[model samples]
Target: MSAVQTQPGGGETRYRIAVDTGGTFTDVVVGSSTGDMAVGKALTTYDRVFTGFEGAVRRAAQSVGWDGDEVLRNADVIVYGTTHATNAVLTGRVAKTALLVTDGFADTLLLREGGRRDAFDSKAAYPPPYIPRQLTFEITERLSAEGEVLTPLDEEQVRSVLRTFPDHGIEAIAVACLWSIINDVHESRIAELIEEVLPGVPYTLSNDANPTIREYRRASAASIDASLKPLMADHLGKLRGDLLQFGFDGDLLVVTSEGAVLDVVDVLDRPVLLLNSGPSMAPLVGAAAAPERETVVVCDMGGTTYDVSLVEKGVVRHTREAWLGEPFVGHLTGLSSVAVTSIGAGGGSIAWIDAGGLLRVGPQSARSTPGPAAYGLGGEEPTVTDACVVLGYLDAQGFEGGFTLDHDAAVKAIETRIAKPLGMDVLVAAQAILDVSGHQMATATRQAALEHGVDPRGALIVAGGGAGAMVAAIIGNILEADTVLIPATAGVLAAYGAHRAPIATEFLSPLHNDTRNFDSASAASAVKELGKKAKFFAARFETVNPDAQFSYFVDARYPGQAWDLRVYLDGAPDATGDAARQIEDAFHAEHDRRNGTHDPASRVEIITWGVRVEIPRHELLSDEVTVTGESVVHRHDPIVFGGESHVTPRYRGVTLSPGQHIAGPAIIDQPTTTIVIPPEWDADLDDRSNIYLNRKEA
Candidate 1:
């Protein structure tokens, strides 16, 4: 794969551009070695994200006194991380897709492995299937679990189904069959037939897409990939064409769920990798920013949800058998930093009185359209943002650079919609809403830390976003984590993550077998093969340096156990056995930590193998060394909240020098976000200008 590179000349300087398209805003950050950083934010265009993205890019370039087209012409890499895929799934705006599965498995997508939609709630209903049963067609083909052919594929029946797809107005086709992971000949043939008949229509096959064990999961994963293919392809194509028109000749990369970047063209074939791309970038950026930290907890509170990820030993945790639609696709893959969980709790989450007259915060969101009631965007209902406004925690007059917030509407909405039904005063109701939302976030943080076998007390929580400051203290108290750090660019942290993200790719293959009897030489050969694949992908971004490193892992399971454990290896032959032992020990430690005991006598087996190749970007100066600065005491202003007023002093994020410390009961304001340090907490500025908050006693 050849890469397009641009050299600085003609009054141009080399630049790296990162564009993050969020629910409410699109942020563009341009970084150059000239010790200059330009940041731009614009209202996101939901109907066409590229319009906002390009606008932000141009604005960012203009801020630095450079033409956007000239900057694009001199840029080395342009990385994009968007919320399109996630929004599509959440809003149910996907294409009309049909699933072609093995006979007798038409209900596989609907069954969802017999797991309830909400595992904790007994009365919760299952989420509706993305593809309806009427669109799920069955084909006559059978293959044994061991890759043995049981019955020949019914080619005539497949052709007949293909003929009806066009008549049914199907946009995409997913071909999945039993045991296709081991033998995908039938599925491939089906895909070929569909393509021949449908021509331009997109088609996906299970074995080619995931190639992991478990029939239903593989099928569902492939179905999701196929379903999103047309949409993703169209979006990427438009973005690429638009950038090219804007004079960007550099290679275009998109962030993946694994915290690495892949070429936009490659992403079209594996759109599933982009499922959690936007939310996953923050942890990666945080980890890179603080490489020395062995363990850190990242809490990214966006408009719609709060995503928490745990980073241990400078790497994000991954899952081997994550549920796509729930049958269990055995593909070991990279996921978001907080692999344990994410919850629907954020600034724009809706707050309303339930049928039982109990106040409930979202699962439902105001999103970008009407937004929160405080946004003054025709939102008549009270929301979390409205609660913040009514409580006076937010400065309604200065919201979004004096974009104008309707405080009266916010209060009135809360009074009639939430306060009246709950039989409480508006101020008290607002406080209750804030407390509940904070409690929900705190509980989620505790659960994630505990489930990951991590001690919450030992982890440093890094909080970012507009809502993070409001909830950080509560979450920190509940998790028992003594230190919490908030970045200066908290609101645009994801965008920064996109800026600092590396251009890399991952390759995986299953190797289910007994580890004790496994051929280490064959495993090494497989690793080499995957490395070649990764190198092939990485070539599109930069020349592969001989010093480029490769990380390997083997997914193992105890014999007779359904779940597997991932064990990282350093790519040495003599250490293979020791690696296996270390993996077993880690598994025992994890199991003991989770279940209070471990069966040491259980035999372990290796299920899959994977390799990730990373190509780092140009290094920037570290924000570690302390700089001398004077501590200026600013006068306090009264902030009315919870039916009372408190004097809160404000500081600027950019003006805070390293080592400058401040006591709590203060507000630190930045253009992107505001951090409220509650009483009993103290904050210290770190090398990177990140504010670390700790309890006074601690």
Candidate 2:
């Protein structure tokens, strides 16, 4: 990683810090430019985000023999990945926002693409829009599809409508006039009026936010971007101020939904990009770990939810339909992001009996506040983490974050809440809780792979997060995967991934052209314009990283298709006959792989032109890890597996050297997490300290 600030001389070397804040814990990773680092974790303090952050950083610094505040002051840059913006949107805790669209489009949000999850189930209620209909005001203006003004801007009417916004306690505004992608004058003028009327009130123009062909999606993007302004602005401002108060003065970068870093100021303006930012980084690690693998499955298990993503053929897939809540009924983000499927089963997922007397793991969690009962934090519910503790998989002394696990509390919680009710043994009940959650993880991994037209069997599974290794081999066993690879930094992989993430941004231009009769000049000009924006953005982002890489993409589909597939071009196209064919071929191949079929003879309709600029990432240097002695089991404990108790040997993972292997019912506990080796598997440590668990021969 590059330095963001000048390094002060005298024994203080340039260092980079990456912090990932999840629902339960905050993980901090401090590394040198060569990527050797230490991970420290702590319970998340939601009330003060920096409190837990400082605690985690201090532990990491202490491990490296440095004072906490001194490390902060001497750091080069800190890349942070947080879930604050995502949580706020999902809980409706964001700023109050008003949506202003063109006349006759007041029902755009109310109708919400008019789709339902189950078409046969008419009893399901329609979900609420991002901005309530009552707050959606229609501006009396119109523009044709070709950028011609069908009706001139009603400036007085706009001013009158906005003047009353203050009374409604609106904190931000989103202006999404129809055809704004073609001509932005109407939306641009509204932005100016907003600045004049409400000087500090944040406003977003659809053209500047997401230049897409779909009016509804563009409007949705604008609505979300506007809604996040006040909340994210204050939240990010406080974070910066906290850093300054700690006497640390360096650049601060934040991860995006696209699995890259952005300037803090840029994130404040486009906070919508912060959604799913942490989960997106898991695929980055997977892709880099086994880039040549045809299909790589990455599962990041946190306290509240587990995210599953796939890296197919060395590329991390991105999707545009990232929903905030339910799939068909929830608000869409309308921006490009890494495709991640999340299941509500993790370390802290509460296990309960359903109405039918069936065991269910979770759609609800204990989060970090009271955490799992194993933490002795006053939580009475039996959670997945409690199961781990009750079964003796988690070691009290080896646990990270300087916390001790309570075996008695875990047993009591399960015995009262689950075992007694089910009339089962305490250990069996705990094992059942893990069985259910493991089923969910396996199901999600299978679905994620199958949905992408890839077979789950014979794939390489890369597990991450604090709780991921606990079930990595279990998922592989269920799916018949060939190998499960656990990186050395698996416990804090998301935070460590920040050290590898590139500084990147994307620009889009709406160009509705077809392959049959392509408008070469028009398409070329749009691509050229996108390139200009990329360069301008890079110029501003250069202070953080100077090197850059550019990639071109287009949204294209068969002529009769309702939706398009985003395809990347090998290089920026000149839009000649050959260039058109290249795009058409690329789209066809991707569409064929994703949809299982494509119409080669049909004309491909290209809707949007895009260019992504990113700082080229430097490959991490893998160091060989060797210990003075062979891997040794320090203790033995009764670990429950397959609903039965087995005395498993526990080994300290960090003390193991390369070429050392452990077989069968065994536990390898590291400072950050634990890995359980199943009865049929063997674990081997590689030179880079990555553990590979492989099943025995049939």
Candidate 3:
């Protein structure tokens, strides 16, 4: 049941809601068109998704002193962000799909681009392909690199093979013909045949799914897209029906891996785009909160993992190499997505003693069902949260949902599971657990920074998530960063991020051109055609965001390079020799910036041209901060930090004023999360109501 508060409203209030369902919590943020926002969080209900979703929504409405029933009836738009597709792909719970490839390419998925995570570790286990060999069918077709059909497609053979799909229990089909990007006739014909032979079965075509130059990535994208069609179609359909049943009559948009929102109808056609849906929203918030022309490392510490991403000049970084699990050992999504590095070091990460009497923190999470031992939810294992309680960093009465933590249970779990095993004090063992996890979290943040060509020491730190503020200062200290920005809505930052993401989509077409032998007429034609498509794409969002904008980019590389780099063009290139030279120069600059080296004098090979169309969100107001200067202390709690116990002054979040200063050895207990100010760090609230943590004087 939703935690509803029966308050009378005018019954005409408009609402915009964003719901992000994570592994541990389902966060809901309700925003009015005027830019007022409120957040609510509840433990994720794996059994009934709507239970947690409605509960969070109700609580958020209550926080704003409004009626939830009225809010639901009048919601204008509801954006939903989910990790369902990501989890399904990683856990091998996707639909049973069949892959149909060109003749003599049955081992394409098996070989997996011929790369390993650790080239020196030959003993590592080899991962199986997405579709089994038995389910892979080879069609008699051939297309050369120049769009010429070397061998005509055997329609009879394709029809004969497709007729047997039912026997193999194939729920969906993926057709990836070799050189389909150069010539799509054969793949298009197969799509027609699939419709004729297996009427109701869903299918994906490489030419339609991803028209890239890479053979493996195109096929991988088609296969993954096809695998998700059946599962997501049913899931989304059910969700829409359930929403209608719950009295919601609004536009339903789902978050995409590309850090934008797509209408549910559009997502139903390309569900694979939802692979990194939930975490992608975090960078949107981080970028918006950060200052322009500056670099910031965004760290979102959730219940199960700590996620890190880099933002430069207010642009969230995007990558094409998103893996399902274990980096190179796992399958690739073969799509451009917001880049994030995640480590298993969150509040729910279990702490235990290894066989050698060494203390180790997770990698392993207790999840939301059992949660932490301190939650009093029948969890017996010691977790990072239990350790936090043992260290007095968390208050027993300050948790979400008006629930109190089990202090005795936290102490018992740590002592019985860790302290007794190592013959050490319970508090000491708890501190060790935190130290290990903090080191891992700090290392990941630094690695993400270095990978994105930003120095950790130079970039500002923006920490979020329910567990993020609890350890933000600790991470900042380890990196020795000057300051950390903790947004007042840090706990539900991703949900807030979903509001900032606009309706956007990308379109790409392939062309082979060289700087010396440039095809200006063909390049102009491709851009013109893509521009039309982008215009049509923008038309769909006219009702919500009419003033859409477009950007153009090119994929080019040094001659004979294995991979190409993307460079956004300031304007569309003309049919002149100078334009070709300019494109070459831009490619060189981008290559150097991303890869740290570029051969400016080398010949350039241009592969793909693309256009991005977006309807940017409306800007109305800044953060709705109403300062009272009435900072109230919850209590003076004795918290352990830096090998010493100190009675820290705990302040309430809502009662704090702008520019209010709180020194070290204090706690700022917000409604959703608690921030532990270590003895060496001092926190001050800015005019935007953001807490800026800086190091104390020497």
Candidate 4:
């Protein structure tokens, strides 16, 4: 396809566009300078990703009476978030990789930190490592923890080992020598030999990708990054080439797991940093949708997974210990990122009977291909969408994007897989599925909140994703939160968040120092070095926004502790008495808030220091639109609840005014999503078009 040219419009109108590619759908959102917003969605096409991306954007542009190419030509910035890296790692579609470790530590990747979720289950088998042990080669190099060389590098041995790569079909390589973070001389030399012998093969060094203290984690990060080199480099290169071909003259940015956007060149170097890129934006969108609420829980129930995150008092929760596939049981990125807890219980999650004849809602999903029996895509198994269809909660004819849902096929799948085996009617079985899935999500949400020491009861829960609005009320009621806020653009909320995300980059350095006699000169030098690196990275965003800001943080803990608490340090890391005192107070405050206790007399040790640089994001201001009349209900339908049917009034969401109120047992239908307010609940619309659901009082 070629770019379609149209008549030139005024050059003063600029647009901000963002596209988020999830496992099941690709959502596109556009924000015009005139305070107008539009969204478009299409099923995810894994084969040719840009096809779905362009299709979604074209649909959105058409709604605003503009050609897709014209919209790109008039855009100021375009940001994108995708699950490509995550999917590649999960499906084992990455390149054949080789690992080079110190002579005796070849099993570092195989023997991960040597822990499991269950300590007593010795019979349980270990999950496969990112790379097998047979693919690992030993290097004759070593360095002490204090950065002193223990054994000189064997240059001939390095050459000999790399010469065999062609026979082994190693497309990528990872180098992880002992104490490489302190002294990377040996690793650097090996890299030079690889470039000479294996000219085109891409490789990753642990010191460059992740300069942390842990050996296993750093090696894991390097392995994952190296394995993704060929896959991500090609994908991102093609995406950029396609965008330029389609007349997008503005800068193209990729969102990172840090809740900010980075240039494609920066992301290509370390694709592991984008593991949780898409889901990381949901919390930011939740905070922006309801700026009035300080604490908010974002529940995004997408087609494949239910992701939950938190923002306390406007600060998005960030963690350095984020795992990719499974927490503790899966591969760790070893990079700092926004903390999100995910469960495999979304609209497309499959429902099936176990060997013992027990009904179970998924940890398995149908994804987009043959998604759900209702999609008429030749799926024989029942999904959560089928349950919604059987219970009359969803209108098959009025489905999202004008796509028809096959109700008969949904009934057949449910009856065949779930109902008959459970000895129940179709409707009853569907409700049971909904109940089980909802409870699972609710429990996971509550645990995510409570584990962070935040009480979700008084917090506002913002719901997003395609199926987010459908279960917002029930999940909120289950958590007993004050209210739940569902944005009008719930279908593409992640893309909206990407649109508003700032251009940011982060730098981390290891600084092992004691707080009592902190070396002011050493700390100041480290800060200066980190600042220089951060400034260099932030230069990429200067074209979009010139004013860049930087913040400093220190990971500290009492002496003899295994873990450290991250404390925000104001200003630069000088050795002044005031700076030291401020850090001590901040550490104590954070410790108290997190663990409910603090010891001021204990000597603190600084483990690592970091710097964050960002260009302030554009504020998402709410526009006031005048409503001329009272809202009217256009239709009514009977919905089954609690084994009984109730006639529910259905209203178009766009026709509702700011002060409008809809009682329980009602449905609010929008173009892309539907909100179901069950019995004993009421819905209120705020001025910003945000819906709030609360329980009714007797």
Of candidates 4 and 1, the better by lDDT: 4
Each candidate's TM vs. the true structure?
0.88, 0.96, 0.96, 0.95
Clashing pairs in 1: 309-337, 309-338, 623-687
List model 1 lDDT by residue over 1-698, tens digit each.
11322334433457778888877667777776454667676667787777878777776766557677666777777889987876676566777899998999887766565446455676766556657889999899999877798989999998888889878999988887988767778888887788777888888888767666655567767777888898998899888887787777887889877776777877898887787677777887568656688788888887778888778878776554444323321122223222635677888888877777777888677876777777777888777778877765566654542267788988988898888877888888888887778788888877777777777788878898657766677678767778888876676777788777766665666656554566666566666677788767566546623345577766667777766666666563233456556556666776675458877877567666677777776654233433335554344666544346678787755567877788877777655566767776789987677788888894
Runs in model 2 deviating more than 4 A are 1-11, 120-125, 542-546, 617-622, 626-630
The CA-based lDDT of model 4 is what? 0.83
Please estimate how well model 3 matches the true structure, expressed as its whole-model Cα lDDT.
0.85
Better of 1 and 3 by lDDT: 3
Greater lDDT among 1 and 2 belongs to 2
Candidate 3: misplaced stretches above 4 Å?
A: 1-11, 118-125, 576-578, 620-622
- Across 278-314, the per-residue lDDT of candidate 4 in tens digits comes to 7988878887776676688899988899999988777
Q: For model 2, what is the error of residue 563's alpha carbon versus the real structure, in angstroms, after optimal superposition?
A: 0.5
